[model samples]
Target chain A: MREEADVVVIGGGVTGCGIAYNLAKKGLTDVIVLERQVPCVGASGRCGGGIRQQFTTDANITLAMESVRLFEQLSVELDTDIEYEQGGYLIIAYEDEVDQFKRNVRLQNSLGLESRFITPEEAREIVPLLNIDPIAGATFCQTDGHANPFRVVHGYARKAQKMGVEISKFTAVTGIVVEDGQIRAVKTDKGTIKTNTVVNAAGAYSRDIASMVGVSLPNKPYRHEILVTEPVEHVLDPMVISFKTGVYFSQQKHGPIIGGIGDPEEPSSYNISASLRFMKRMARTVVELVPAFGHLNVLRQWAGLYDVTPDAQPVLGWTEGVDQFCQANGYSGHGFMIAPKVTELIAELIVDGKPSMPIDDLNLKRFEGEITGEAYVVG
Target chain B: MTEIVCRCEDITEEDILDAIDQGYTTLEEIKRVLRCGMGPCQGRTCIPLITRIVARKTGKSLAEVSRPTTRPPLQPLPLSVFAGEEE
Candidate 1:
């Protein structure tokens, strides 16, 4: 491992790798990415891979819209087949959520996202097997979809390495050497890398990394479970999600139906063990939504953590007391969906001293006062 | 003659080596990149074969290569089973 670098990014997941790739693309090649395990070994590899732009918050909607544009060209830009499918995302609404969804659709349409609130019958037209009896209304965004999270991480890491960025796997960050409120070096199990700038893109462990610099972050990790069924005929295209039950599912390009459900009772922790209760709840919810899924065999079940903040939004930009210590974690559960644009903006912030987009609304300082939480977060 | 390692994903020995050459040296890394152990069988048939290949190529002992994590339902089961419906 190199003893020195211009910048040292703390994780090698999609967020970290994406940031590294973007940094290198912008002429910052003397960078190193440290991963506790192999790339995509965290939430980046375990997510349901659904990318959507139908968020209730303007920050999330604008970020996802720009990310969708980047994802449309990511496969060609990274020189890898990321299996990106832009079939669209359908968010079903229950009786109580109808008004909220109407306002969300209006806000989304105002932001130039071609999202429209449709009837239950229209939703069934999009998803033929959907049980729309409980759906009061639905919103559809044709530009939102899913992709292979593993391939996305692989493409970013490979391209970043080819561009002369070093990626060190199995290297755990132990501490951060800070003097006079400026980052001087990063201590790891292998050796310390002398660097002036550090980006905390550590995903679920971002809070822990922040603590190393004596900066307290409010982000906490929450476990979410997902399952995939055996590869079958491609019946479903767009990802169908329900705001009422927090159950979502989509068919991969190769045919497996992958989905997940959120357990409201889940406590905040780093625990990612798959549970029988989650499996049962997910099975019941999915079958209740689409009875045809009961016939498919579940191949595997796994879990990943969502680095959640109080507002369910990501904390970006530089830290308050620590100079040159960039904060880029806390995506809640939608990191992969917005990674392309988020990483690009973060790179611009680090290299050009400013980002084109106005991200002051997403900084850690927002937590000091009253914040409006995002309402469209799904499992 | 080419040797097929993962029948579920139709992955050949050459495919595994290519993924390893691309810096995906571990069992889990190769599985994500190539889908060797992620098919219907869930690595039942291919895990052992791929482990040996990875050990030989990376000069690591069989015990040195970390085993693939075994997740639930051991075998494929209908969603109805978990949903509390009779098969």
Candidate 2:
């Protein structure tokens, strides 16, 4: 490993690799990505890979829309098949969430998204397997879908490597050296590297990395669990989600049904151990939503951490006191969906000193006062 | 003649070696990239075979090559069984 570098990215997930690739594409090739384990070993590899624009926040919807566009052409640009499928996302609403669904669909439409409100009967028409007895209504966005997260990270990492970005696997960052409120170097388990800029793209460990430079971030890690069933003939097209039950499920391109549910009672911790509780709860919820799923055999189950914030939004831009220490984490649970656009904007911010898109509202300083939390975050 | 290590995913010994050559040395990393051990068997038969190949290729002992993580329901079971429904 070289003893010096221009910029050192702290994580090797899609966000870190994507940022590295975009930066190198913009002629900043002297970058090094440090991964604790292999690439996509974190939340990126563990997520359900559901990409949707049906969000309650403007920043999320805007970022998701652009990310979808980028994902459409990502396979061609990266010279790899990311398995991007725009099969659409269906968010079923219960009686209590019908009004919120209306408002969300209207806002999404006004923002140029093709999202619209559909009745429960229409939802069943789209997904005949859906048990719509408990559904009051739903919102559907045809442009939203799922992709292979592993292939995406692999594509970005491979392209970044081809563009002369060094990716160091099995390397863990120990500390960040800040001198007079400016980044000076990064100390890893392998050795220390002298650098002027650092991107804290560490997913669940972003808060830990920020604290190395004495910057306090309010991000906490919450354990989220997911499971997949044995592959069968393709049946489910759209990803089915419900805000009330906190359950989301979609059929993968390979034929298996993958999904998860959020436990409101889950505490903040790094514990990623899969639980019997989650499996039971997920089984009950999914079977009730779609009875056909009850006959499908569950193949495997796993868990990953969601680096959560108080407002359920990512902390982008630079930190208040730490100069050259860019914040690119705190994505809660939707990091994989918004990584393409978020990393592109972050790269623009680093190279051009300003992003083409407006991200002033997503800075780290917004947590001081009252903030409106995002309402559409699923498990 | 080509030798298939992971029959579930139809992956061969050459494919596993190629993935290892591309810097994916770990079992989990190779599994994610090649989908060798991710099939219905869940790495039951292929894990041992791939372990030996990885060990021989990377010059590590079989013990040194970490095993793939084993998850629940050792066999594939329907969701109705877990949901407490009469199937």
Candidate 3:
């Protein structure tokens, strides 16, 4: 790799590529992105690919709303097919979460989103295959959808490379050299790159990068597994999500039903091994939600790590001691959905010194105090 | 050339035994050496079958024979996604 110049972005997933693309657009050429493996080798490639604006918090909803707008024009802007489909996201709620679902819908409505609370029967109308017996209430947003994760990251990486951003795959960063509270260079297995700015976008390994700079980040990595069923005739239209079960499923454009479930008790580690426990739990929940899923054969299963913060919000902007180091990590499980907007803000922060959008609440300092509301709609 | 176990990669029971003869013991190692379960299905079809073969060959239980470490890009993707256009 070249000796490097302006900015060094770690992690070649969607977020890192998104940052590189935005930074290159800002005329910051000589950008280097380092990925330990191929792009989308982590959670970005393994996620459910569900882009939803139906969030309980304004921060998440706003981020998703802006990202959806970008995704609408991405295929043309990036000159590649992202396979984006706006089949919408249907969030069904049990009796316990009905109040929270109603409040979330009202909050989403106040922000000019067309999200609304619908009866269980209306949910069935949207997805006829759904078993609505257990669903007490539901929320629907037509703007939410899923895209091909591989295509999305590849588009960003390809578009950024065309703009003079160098993405080095299989380049593992061993350490970050910081001197007197300023970043000096990033040490990698390939070679050392002298840089004044470092964007620690290393998804699950963000904490490890932070510790190298003598800073501590509260983000932990948890294994989240997903499986796909054999492709069949189009049956499900929208991504069906349940907060209580932490399970979500959606039909891809190619026909496979892809989805995953979260185990809260799963310890923080980099173990990506898929478990039979998850398979059994997912089958039980999915079949209960849509009885037709019981007949479909499961084709494959895999796991990815979620870089989660305590409050489930991302820690953006500059850290305290590291002057030249900026962070755009800790997106929890929804990083793929909000990547475009978050990376745009990170680009603004790196080049123009401030983001056009306000993300003051999303910082590491917020974790020092008693952290209140979390992004409860995690799947 | 016996019954096909891994439909994704078209690997059969005889192929699996040959893989064992070649010293590919673990599920992950066998996948790398023989391509037994490394296909579009990512071993979902052949893991159980291969587990049985490895267990019976090595005289170990299925639980003792650990599965291979699942790497990223769990599914096969086109190389064009990475190969930059000729300028």
Cα deviation at A45, candidate 3, in Å, is 0.8
| Each model's backbone clash number | 0, 0, 0
lDDT of 2 by residue, A67-118 (tens): 9999999999999889899989999888988887888888998999999989
lDDT of candidate 2 at residue A198, scale 0 to 100? 96
lDDT per residue (tens digit) for residues A229-322 in model 1? 9999989979999867889999999999999999899999989898999989999989888999999999999999999999989999988999
Overall lDDT per candidate, in order of appearance: 0.93, 0.92, 0.83
Candidate by candidate, in order, the iRMS in Å equals 1.1, 1.2, 16.0
lDDT (tens digit, per residue) of candidate 3 on A1-379:
9786699999989999999999999999789999997677788877989999887777888999999999999899888888899999998888988887888888989998898888999999999988989889798999899988877887888789999999887799999888888888999999999999999999999999899878999999999998776667898888889888999999988687889888877898999887767777777778778776777767567899999888888989889988878888998899999988999999998899989998888978888889865556555
lDDT for A348 (candidate 1): 96
How does candidate 1 score on lDDT? 0.93
**Where is model 1 more than 4 Å wrong at Cα?**
B85-87
True contacts kept of 1: 0.80
Question: Candidate 1 clashing pairs?
Answer: none
Worst lDDT 10-window in candidate 3 chain A: A370-379
- Which is the winner by DockQ between candidate 2 and candidate 3? 2
Q: Pick out the ten consecutive residues of candidate 2 chain A with the lowest summed lDDT.
A: A97-106
Which model scores highest in lDDT?
1
